[model samples]
Target: MVLKCSPIQLAHSVLLTLGIIWLTPVWAAQEIRVGAAHFPPYTVRPERGADTGLLSKLLNALNQLQSDYRFVLVPSSIPRRVRDFERGRVDMMMFENPAWGWQELSYTAVDMGLEDAEVFVARQNPDRAQRYFDDLSGKRLALFSGYHYAFAGFNSAPKFLTNTFSATLTYSHESNLLMVLRGRADIALMTRSNLIDIQRYDPKVKSQIMVSERVDQVYRHYALLRLDAPIKSQEFAQMLNNLRDSGQLRAIFGPYQIDVVAM
Candidate 1:
């Protein structure tokens, strides 16, 4: 056992070990946890089963395109997402905008080149004249509790909105729209794409509500990656672009009336 090992033997052993490590692929696939809220036509969490929506479709295509990373959804509410991101509960957020109160957060911003508009929805009463979105002064608005709207001066506080314009803020878009139909609220602001999807699936929604010619804002969407996220910002964009090139992007949104702003 006291015999000296030759330099060549030692070198071969080291090389063999290195080769084994190289072949073994020791690291697990990097997990990219995406923060998802119940934003219909984008991400919808169903009552009985798995979540389904546009964002869900996009993530599926992205997952199919690679093996280095596995994307998974991390459930979050509209108000709770920022805290989750800061606490590292989620690694990224899709279909986001900086103006949506995310300015102070530490994250990489990647322009998605996607656009969706939020418009006013009210019950169909052909006898009534067209109502504009410029004023919320006397309206009993059915607003989403955790959302920021351009017309509301980007305010999400129920009390402030209530004092300003008789608003009934709730979490569900369906509920908001229902309030409008049942004479509980004067109007509900919702995404144009969601309206299309809802109208297609539910004839009740189609027969009762009328989409306003008034729109609050056309969102130029983006992907926000936390500072500690596994993938680089540019790399995530590349994955998205790959989906764009493959016709998957348009396919997912085209039927819903959501057009891709970029390829």
Candidate 2:
């Protein structure tokens, strides 16, 4: 026996099949959880809502570039991020350095080919010159909590910073800068990228604050991947290279004064 379907019925069948194909991907996109810490100009976690920064922009661009992997931001703190990565809470960490307490962990480090530096910010005064920054012995330091500074021997202990350096630990870089501007603190250590951002938005900051030529640390950024991560370091590095070639990375990080070196 032979059967023939009507044109309307055949069209309906085709439409249904097309809908199924549209709804399903060729393969499930592997989920890659990236740690999102509150690093200004790199990543910012507001009092509420999702995080945003250069990291966010880079992730968004990576997502649009490929469908095999879905990169999602997982909230983590400066002190807790290493632990989170160790515990499998996050599979990847971007804009990190190996010397920043990661020596003990076994992970592949992919050099991000980016560079930034930490500099001192102080209120401008007629008498204060570059010499004022030469000695921090009696200076009141305003520092970000959980951040390691070369000046402090890379120790991020709050009590150590407070007692040894007479430092006040806070979470906001802006607050630290303001501390200097208001004479609440003698000096504030800020990232060059962040200071540039602040000066861009508030031009008065450039005139009111004197930035030291001395650097606390020069950040050579890297992306650390867990040993068992879905994506390998080579693969991730290639992805970054793709972004660099396509100019996406420059578009995202250039404005912040971050160097986009070829991989």
Candidate 3:
């Protein structure tokens, strides 16, 4: 039995079919909540309405590349991320280091094969040279609160940092840098990628500061996944590898001086 349909009916049927096909993935895709902290260059403006950072970009790329999962950002602070992860508020945390207080947690650590270092910054002066960064004694340090420092034996306690290193803890990297320029602080510790972004935005500020040749620590990035995460660490690593092979990672992080090592 062959029934001929009108042009309008045929068009309607085609449209309905297309809509169902498009909606299938969205319905079936698992939600993967990624923790986004106020980590600059990696995650900037996280508290703002819309996040603009490498993590956001990477998630966008991941979404576009696959339909099996839907990646979303769950805002968390540096100090609260660990709690959030344990509470299942977020399934994954990217740009993390295992040594940064994640050692005791039972989770899978996926090597991101990316690297960025922490460097010292100080105001430029005739008397100040690379040698100025060689010593930490008698120096007032400005650092981000809730960040573990290798110099302090990975201690992130505000009281410990203040008493042991004479540190001024703050949330703003810009403020830390300004403290150095204003001579309120002798040195400010910040990520190399962050410094690059700052210098790129404010070229004039670049000349006013001296970056240290000695790095305080090299940040070997990782993705820490909960044991019950929607996806396994191996799967996440493969997605990152795909991004690396397609040059997406390089395009996103290369300008910021974040190294994307081959997996």
Candidate 4:
């Protein structure tokens, strides 16, 4: 006859199985996949062979913390990038200003300690440049796909353009600059820092670019992580905060001429 198992013995076996399942290595190793655009100086492709700008240094600092990170460069659009992140296709991304409507998606945002000034880049011709926004009253203005602008005092104007300006709006920082060079669009909106970075990578675009107006100032260059990421989002936020406190951020961005701002 077979011996009957005791209740305590059966309980011990159950606990052992549960413990093994909980202690599995797969539960411990987590990865974060970040999405970004080739908005040079802020973020760019490694194949470009130019400086990765502040984003590169920021990523390096994050890597130094030994965190697992994967980067994906989205083409010409931030809303698309956000869509990818929401679907769990990507774990995080960079440089999302708080104004973007993704705060509820459970992504943690960290201050990369950089500020950006928004400006309109128009043709150097006085009449043409002055008519940029005016002529676009019923037309489209090119803006970075997911960028936001406060418009300072022009918030009530009918033609105060931005990504949210209208469905007719078309945007591509590189393409927009190219358009200005070719006189295709009325105006292109961009950040001063980004313009400088783009010029550094492609000198040919420089002559066609000039700041038409300093529209608004905003804190730029922050890191974002999916709220449901396997690793704690708070931990990542804290790591960035520590980097800022220890001056590591300063050291990393100093060479790029970026100024850090607290969020």
Candidate 5:
């Protein structure tokens, strides 16, 4: 079985190997930092080895789809998002609404074709059933620290909210819901999506909470990108569209009891 190749044959084999390597596409991976707030179901601050949320799942899919761009989540808060974006500490903000105050900033908006709603949540008090959310006067409320609501005339100033409406400001939806559950607050304004997710994660919490019919606003979420971001709005939209067409979105959000809206 012993065989020897000529010098010319060996040279040809080496050249073929070099040609294949040269023709291979070698891409420089670009890092895309996506700002993340404490929006449950969409994003929860990632743990050491656990990426637990919708945004994490979506970002993982995006990373897998393209080798050129590596999407990542950067920590931020509702009040500090502007500072994060303006300082170039983060490249983009995900699942944002224009009304959240990025209008004056240099950024582009891309409609994500996903939506959620802000609604009122209260404790499951049988005695006060059907009479809890009837009036807003003289009622204690728990609300997110820096969110503008339709009922507040979209005024999210902490001083105005605490002084005018006597609202208790919380940094997290879980805290707001907990306040309502313990009767510490009359009602808490929360996202319908978050409520759904909380119920999914802890079924017992569902029995402790009751939701109201009064919806604050329906949110059509978007990705707000800086003007100097590595990716443009349209290009980002195209990548999302590819995910939608391939049914990846449904696979990711469906199990969480969320419906993927058509783009």
Candidate 6:
């Protein structure tokens, strides 16, 4: 049958098809994969069906805002993680302070909304060995392998001794704390909030541990994003800033005793 169709009929059919396409659930599903390390009290491994700490809370909030994103724990090594993200093996990853000097690596600084402070934790034993950086010269000092110092240049003093003192480096803050508790390592450097969280989980260790000294006060943590991420870094930063201003950020972290550092 040969029949003439009106222009309006063709236009209406096209609009209906377009509307159906736009209404599909797949159109709203934006897949953004994130990588993280197992840093206790912030991010931890799910053991025996346990929830990973504060990071879990943060992820929950993120999920509320986003529908199609998931975070996976990457090993605590910055170099390897960066390589993965750069090569498009992973979509995004969070970092405290990345050493990547490349302009292509876009990052959104979260400001952590917490105070920047470092503490030197050691065992409480006067006879064994009091607090002495010199004593730590030949021994090993442990820090989280993948973490970076936000205020690296602020502390001008050399971390290691030159000639008479040489120390080995160990990774993993949790392991480092264990070493200190067991008297394996002379001292372990950690953040104050992290120490508090650890103590909460293991109260017996609190009696044996002591915060020797405040190393630095401006060691704020930040969330570094990849430049090629589907979400804009600057926009994320603004959203975080707005979250802080609205008091929602503080509320989210306050229960966990994490203070928010205003941007």
- Which candidate leads in lDDT? 3
| lDDT tens readout by residue for model 2, 1-263 | 98999999999999999999999877899999999889998888822457677888989999998988999888888888999999999999999999888999999999998998999999999998998889999999999999989999999999999999999999999999989999999999999999998899899788898999998888899999999999999888888899999998888889988998866
Question: Against the unseen true structure, what C-alpha lDDT does each candidate score?
Answer: 0.84, 0.91, 0.92, 0.62, 0.84, 0.59
Candidate 3 TM-score to native = 0.90
TM-score list, all predictions: 0.87, 0.90, 0.90, 0.64, 0.85, 0.69
Candidate 3, residue 185: Cα displacement in angstroms equals 0.5
Tens-place lDDT digits, model 1, residues 163-187: 8878888878889888999999988
What is the Cα-based lDDT of residue 142 in candidate 5? Answer: 96
- Which of 3 and 6 is ahead in TM-score? 3
> What's model 2's overall lDDT?
0.91
How much lDDT does candidate 4 score?
A: 0.62
lDDT score for residue 105 of model 3 = 86
Task: Output the better candidate (4/6) by TM-score.
Answer: 6
- Tens digits of per-residue lDDT, candidate 3, 177-211, equal 99999999999999999999998899999889999
lDDT against true structure, model 1: 0.84
Worst 10 residues of 2 by lDDT: 45-54
Name the runs in model 2 displaced over 4 angstroms: 1-23
Q: Which stretches of candidate 6 lie above 4 Å from their native place?
A: 1-23, 46-51, 66-79, 99-112, 126-140, 149-171, 255-257
Q: Assess the local accuracy of residue 177 in candidate 2 as a C-alpha lDDT between 0 and 100.
A: 93
How many residue pairs in model 3 have overlapping backbones?
Answer: 0
Off by over 4 Å in 1: 1-26, 46-49, 132-134
Model 1 residue 213 CA deviation in Å: 1.0
